[model samples]
Target: MTARHVLLLTAAAYASDPDGPWVDGGLVLRAAARAGLGPSALDAAERAGLERSPDGRLRLPGRRAVYEAAHPARRRAAHRLLAEAALGERLRPAGLLHRALAAPYPDSALGTELAAAARLPGPSHGERATALAHAAGLAADPEVRAGRFVAAADQARLAGRPHRARELLGRIDELTPTDAVRGAAALVRGLLALRDGPMADARASLLLAARLCPGERALDARLAAAEAAWALGDALAYQEAVAGQLSGAATARAFGLGMAAALDDRYAAGRVTLRRVVADAAGAGAPDALLRAGAAALVAGDVEAACRLGSRALAAARALDARPELPRALELLAYGELRAGRHARARTHAEEGLRAARAAGQRNVLAHQHAILALVASLDSDADTVARHAAAAQDIAARHGLVQAATLAQWALARADLARGRAAEAAARLGPLVRPGPRQGHFAVRMLAVPCFVEAAVSAGDLGAARAAVAEFNVWADRGYDPQAGALLARCQALLSAGDPVRADARFTEALARHERAGGDFERARTAELHGEWLRRARRPARARVLLRDALVAFERCGASVWAVRTAAELRATGDAPSHPEAPGRLSELTPQQLRIAHCVADGATNREVASRLSVSPRTVDHHLRNVFAQLGVRSRVELARLVDRAEATRAL
Candidate 1:
């Protein structure tokens, strides 16, 4: 038999009528003739494949491969023909479907293409199949139209036209509203809001989408909601989003979950998630993971690990030419430097990141940059710069609802007030953040500011407040809020709750060691200064000299002139030769950091050696080394060393 006859026979065999007898040979030949096959021609066709069994029943030879030989289009046509031909004669469709498919579809390029297809008048089988396929495409149900629009919107977004994507999403409502369409629409809106502005809007839209989304798309919608909640600074929402297990061990899923954990300040949990992402990662988003994991490491107090990951992130971003990631990488690098007391290098990184973020129109990064700059200025005792940058950062962070950025900027201003002896006012300024009510503060930021608030409160004679802050800090310490927190807590305890000189001294000593272990030079310096002050008041000026000298050197290394001058006064009161009141020469012109780098180079320390002592990168050491040479009008390390020594000796004389 011909191919059509074989298909007819196959369909007839599989689709038996419950109310009718098996189709015998005579009936098959009659149906074929009615289907336009001539009787003599059908008899002349090959019948080798359609052999009969001993019982006289047709048993066509079939194989799995033979079954796949026919195209789906042909199978569908034969099946439709059998449904009609089995009942009686074929009932041809009126021209309505044909005219609809052939007509110009409003705003549809697809209909135009279908119209171009030949609508032949003759009864050829292929032409009939083609016409039916065209009509079927035009008559697709509303659910199919919604899915098509969702797919088109995704493509438009990938093509960098989010407005076009939103427009296509709007077309979904015009067709029909299925759970799938509404869920997809909400998911896209959430993702877009995440990138465009405040995350509150994104979180709300994503929550509804995750709840209503059905089927395989459910996991994706949940991921979107979790990320939106993280961006909106809600840790609880992130917790719930990852509660439902992911569908697979997908690297993207790991990355999303890992980022949520990190933003929620669950660093240990985030690290676990990041490790999973790394194991499953195919190098697609590994660089992004590196950046986020590095920040988490910094917060966890792993200084060396943070530096290692930061260096890798910077290199990867540059290698991939991932301009969008550059600002974040640079921002993290600056934070690492700031934590390590590498103020000069931190300033460079923050300034560079600010320019990159502004050019990229990343306002979130811009707000963080200004906050970092504010802190840097506060450290440098540049009150005017600190005030200006802090105000700018405050405005941006508040307007954008950035909890962390705003908190950091507020902390910077409070630190400045504390430096200027306005301890009472500083205590008032930080009290709200240090003891936040309900869900009002960022965990990491509050963790960082608590120690400072305790010192401020104690200095302002609010002993009860100081003790309460200390208790709160102990709670954070138990949860492993910060790596350097132990040392800071000890120092606070020594100042606020210690009963004897011996206990206070022991606590101070422990805090100093912890600061060194954590590689926080500025913190160590401040601790030494406080301990020296305590010793001086106890009539042990000689014992105070050693810690006072160390504090002076550390303050100089961090470019903390305001604190350094105070240390100098404390040193002078200890009967030590203090820094010259008006130190003459180029030494005064150089920054405290530059002066310290010069001292290290003058003592013949290598770049790596200096970097180890200063808790900074060798590259940072080299950069500061070069600056020291240029600023002092020297040609080499030798000249830079000689010039610095000569200037110092002259100032003393």
Candidate 2:
């Protein structure tokens, strides 16, 4: 029946029996959210005191106060108020009329209200399935028992636990074989196949189920399977499969089908499908569909829509005490917050999700949580924490046969090493990840490999290989895949190798900008340290000293002992080091920027040429030479060049 009709029936039942099932409000709210209704509507309903109980029933306050005091005619008015409030714009009269007839005392005022609402269209098949699933555990009828088992399977699939759902379906088969039971079993098998990493099997199972059920059950599975096939590049199969299922499935099927279309780059078609899915799911109380709708909204870059849908999903998940969906919902919320530059809130949500995943023993979720944590740590420039978490992730991935995750963990480790001045070690560790090979099963893992390869090549001073690696990275970046800070560092190193010192300096500045935007100062400090080195090489010792000193402070704050020590060494040599209260001027300047600049100039340019190149007049170049005469710097430009070159050579050795 229509949502309005259901609400009217629920209201009448409540009026007649104050304790009757009126908990359908939650389900209605869920459906409305899926249908793309504004959060304001749901909030209004909540404020109006429509809360769903844990048992999936509506809990209205002071049930006897309104119904008992009202006449039969007034009772109908109450039912209308409840129905209008619950269904909102989604209500129609046809479904309401049907609900009226189904209620007790069909000729009563309550029944009349239901009859009027019954004229409206009812929830789509997918919504019906969702509602059935939500109320299944409380249902006692044999048909409902079977349907509940199926709904259980659907829940399992949505939570990424297809294996458990499959097992449950197997048990359901032992009970009886109704159309719903058989259809749900087939759909469950298809979902299981999809989860098992076999799109072909999933498609076949779903296609067969589509012919058998020809309702929401088969339609949902078929569309999901089609999308899987499309993702695997079987476009023709996807089209044929979708075409066959489209004529029978509910509008919500379009959402799943649209997801497939989007994967195939049919953006327009995907948009059309998702819109319908949202509408239909909103009409039928389906939290899973609402979550999908929210995700789609996010993909479309509709921040408002995403927040509305996500809020609804979160509410439903909370109402149901479904802890599994909680993390997924929280992740979406965190993503939104992160986009808005609310890093503190984002981190809070991310940590909450991690805790939930750990409590539930969900390894896949745990892996994702750790990856996010690594990103946070990278932003914070807490190299030790990043390394520890990344290693843990790799260990978990290896144990779970997740090759792509292992690769990412290795990349994270390489980044940690690079930050600690262990470039050679980082190069060795990241070398194997960048080699040409067949596509890894995980998309994230494969994408990660490109940056790791670039970093290693640049670190090892293999400019040719780095250039080649960057060509691949540029492709992914062009496709809208922006790598994280660690990857950006690799890009900066390549720019430095290309000798565009200015652009390289700009890239370092950009990295720091991003780090600060991500709500952490650690990466900014590290970038500043690198920028100082670049500046020092460019003959800007004054500015370099300030940057290096700041970096040293950051390193010490983050407990980065290796980096702190190295920065201190650079500080002393620059003659800009902070004075020790106990031993002032105890540190000696080992090398100076002017000396390096002189070496670079004399190695290739004449005195007049060096003066022009360094933006100094010829007279100043001669004056510096006179000072050079007094200092062990020597008399002639050639001798000065020799001394500076020898010092550089010794340092390199």
Candidate 3:
């Protein structure tokens, strides 16, 4: 055969089921050989770089253009040859699947066999059979096709393939399915919408699912409806959705009630309910139930339990290959790590979760991960990274009506402003978010940002506004809603009392005492810096130097570079430099993405190679490389390589 024929035959093997990410190399060769192409077809395609993917799987490198370019008659012949080869006495499931896929028309006999195969219990069988059923146009028998498609859609949704799930559901819609089958498909669609949303559409689909679905699925739909209502910021609707879950004993429903109570500020009741929910979910060993309880634990201020539950949920999800739940588990873990002041671990989890969320098409989860990454950047005082991540998050949140994600992104932006000494701007940006009005942010999130707002208002000389915010924060602190609440509240009070030296001195002392008990290094350092600055202004240089030195050390430990520079300046003003100031890492100034790109480029990889490795567009790699060059002050790839080598060598010291 000619080279063109070899390529077309190989392309036809993959085009037969183009939805999958990869086709087995052996399967491709066998199918092509059966199509009158020699076994040398694989060798020729490999030589042409058509099988150039590092995984050795058969897929068109740049879209399916090569397969689409083939003549229609040739493609059908190739599929028929594969189907003919699959007809054996003791047929394996894989061979049987090929036969079903090559059906010339909507053969009801072939449809029945594939539908039965789909109903067989296995991890991948259902998805494969249903995809083949639809791709082969097997909807002539509605009874066989409808049930199979509905189950496949649910499996796709659970596996975190939202687009695939929707495609299957759309196929089901073309058939005359029974009410139950249609309701089942709607349930999966609603769940998919909740993950990749327009909250309004998710709520509508879920309500329909609840009305038409039966038993457990109805309960599941109602529970998801409650979450969608909460995300939309409709308090009345949230309550109604929660009321609908009252009749169910599902562990997820218990989790929903606990989350609602916590959001309502009944932390004690919420914690109690969530504790039982966690135990029940653990006994049931359901990944989804574990995620619901884990999220509730985070909201209840039980960070330790939340982390534990998150770890368990992640393990279970991976073991069962539950793709949709994986990102949710990671989000819970990242949030817990952030609350506990494990900034490095939090950033790691957020980055991994961001990638998984992208793959799963979980838009809401992606927004949440972006917001978390922004918060991590804020702690590092990296304003540009903060702005970039926050912008990405807010863009998604606005489109999806995700109040919590939007609130978190706004808080990150305001915090970045404060770090850059734009106190007035920060205060202006955060005031409406913290205060109650139509433009106010989510209740739980806005409350967490109150300390930042108070600090900004105080810095901008708006003492009256600062005082009111501090008073409200004091109530939350009294309730013990956060482990670091006492320290943050004391710091806020000290800021408001700065004009009264004696009162301010007392509050500063109280803040430092509370800081000794708090977990967050960055927050503790901020309090110390404020106290030291006040002492220096009071002409108490001796005491100021001591506090300033400690603050500088704490800031450096937490990688808060901006805060470290300011604290170092304060220490010098008090006649003391940061006495053992450690030398910074050579690549310390680079953002995570820039660092990755620089390392890749330094390793002698071309831009295209780096882009493929990172699963990003070449243009994105080029854009980040420009910023990396500017930041590192390297004029060419050669200088960048030298700089990276020296940095690596210095780290070895």
Candidate 4:
């Protein structure tokens, strides 16, 4: 056989697989043999018009022209021959493609195989997706086409193509689909709406999906509806979504029910159920389950457990390509770190979570991340950042009825007001949020904000209001959910008991004692500052100096610059100027990511180890480390370690 015959045969083989840009090299070889051409002619054809990619796939240049030029009979022969060859080679997608093309009309047999392969979870997702798309177009029956399109819509959604997913879902309207197939389509639509906004629509679609789907899928749809209800702060909807579903041992279902309990303020029941979620999810493979369980742990006030679960979820989500869960996992870590009083670490996680939420089109998670960032900025007295993030969060929350995000953003704004010493403004701002009213904040957050409300009220000289707020705060503190709640409650009591010197001193002393057992340095510092102020007013300058100085140092160490400044001024008022005021340290100048990398490297973690621990690429670790070194003016890891040691020693003082 001449090289001319090889080119013609290879072009016909390429034409047989016209949907793909190129044909498999093995297909070309099979076609050549069927054409009575020796294997040696293939090399000559390669030197002719046939081209080979670096990946070893075969293509014929001007293949479209070659295909159009070919006789109809020859193309049919090539399709039959190529289909048989693909089957023999066990190329399922290729054989299905060729066999479907060889049919005169839509082929149901080929479409079934293609649809099954496309829906199967595997590494070759793109190939499966392409084959199924072709199969759906050529399917003979309307129901079969609708079913295939349903799977295709799911594949598009999972692949992060929202528009294409919606387009595929639209195709279902033109055909008759079984309830199961229609239900599956609804589930995908609900998930997309759940990620992207309008919580009411998401909840409606999810509830519909739950009713229409099979048993297992119904459970999934219900759990997802529970999520939308949680975001909307619709407790009744949350209960309805998870009703009669708490008996199961599945980690996800238990987590959803636990969250429902949290929304109901049943801390004991929620914590007990969430403990099971934590245990079960530790061994569960689904990243979404781990994320849901982590969220339950967060709501149960188990900050350390939540952080641990969030880390595992983040790593697993990335490994499993679960992009939608990535932001939620990061949110758990950020909020946990914030509660743990690691402001810089919280900032780092919040910053990354915000980006992930935006990329994944999770508007509600995006708003929540913004609120986290806003709170972080409020701590540092960065009013612009606080306002910017809070506004961004509130705007989205208003449009989508995101109650949690709105509550968090408002709390951040009020915290900024209190930090800046606008006590009256802060008190007014927090009144509706903490009290029972039409504009009241979320239940859990409203309770958490009570301490701040009490402080603001006391500072504004509204002792009656402060006392009433403390009475409510006392109830939450007695529950023992938040470790810092007890300490904060004592401080509030001291603020209200200033008229009785002995009672005021006792409450202040109790607050300081409780602070030792709590985790947040910021809260501890607030108590110390308040106690010092009381002592100074009571003509005890020496004791006032000690507490004030301690509060000042703690504030600076935790990056609460405004609080540090206020504490320093209080110390100075006692006629004792602070010797170690806020100083710019190498650690303080670095961004959150850079600072974390510096600390890890200084602790003797290699770049790869840091990357693994943070669930980022080693190259990302290396890049951040270089920026850390440049920012800190450090030449080596040894220098960074020395700097970190000095910073720790300074903070310890």
* Local lDDT at 363 for model 4: 80
- With a 3 Å backbone cut-off (N, CA, C), the pairs that clash in candidate 4 are none
TM-score sort, best first = 3, 4, 1, 2
Tens-digit lDDT track of model 2 for 1-653: 13333333334434222223344554445544444455575445456655666666666565455335546654454444444445443433322432342334433343334323322344322232333333343344556557666765665555445455665576565567687567767777775654343456667777777767755656676676664554343556666676643654455556556655654557667766665665555654456667777766644444456666767887887776554566667666665554443445656777886777665445544655565565455433335577767877666655544454456566666665664456777767666556454533344244445554565566678777666656656554433322243435444553545478767766776766665644434445656776787777778899889899888777656544445545655654565522422221111122353554455444534345556677877677666655554655354433443344345434454
Model 3 pairs whose backbones collide: none
Deviation from truth (RMSD, Å), model 2: 17.1
Per-residue lDDT over 310-368 for candidate 1, one digit per residue giving the tens place of the 0 to 100 score: 66787787776455567777888887787667877788889998887775556767778
Q: How high is the CA lDDT of each candidate model?
A: 0.64, 0.54, 0.74, 0.77
Top-scoring candidate (lDDT): 4
Please report the candidate that would top TM-score against the real structure: 3
Each candidate structure's TM-score, on Cα atoms with residue i matched to residue i, is: 0.61, 0.51, 0.78, 0.76
What are the candidates' C-alpha RMSDs? 19.0, 17.1, 9.0, 10.0
Q: Tell how far residue 39 is off in model 4, in angstroms.
A: 18
lDDT of 4 by residue, 222-291 (tens): 9889888878877778888988854334666777777777656686787788888877776877777777
User: What number of backbone clashes does candidate 2 have, counting pairs of residues 3 or more apart or in separate chains?
Assistant: 25
lDDT of 1 at 612: 81
Model 1 scores a C-alpha lDDT of 0.64
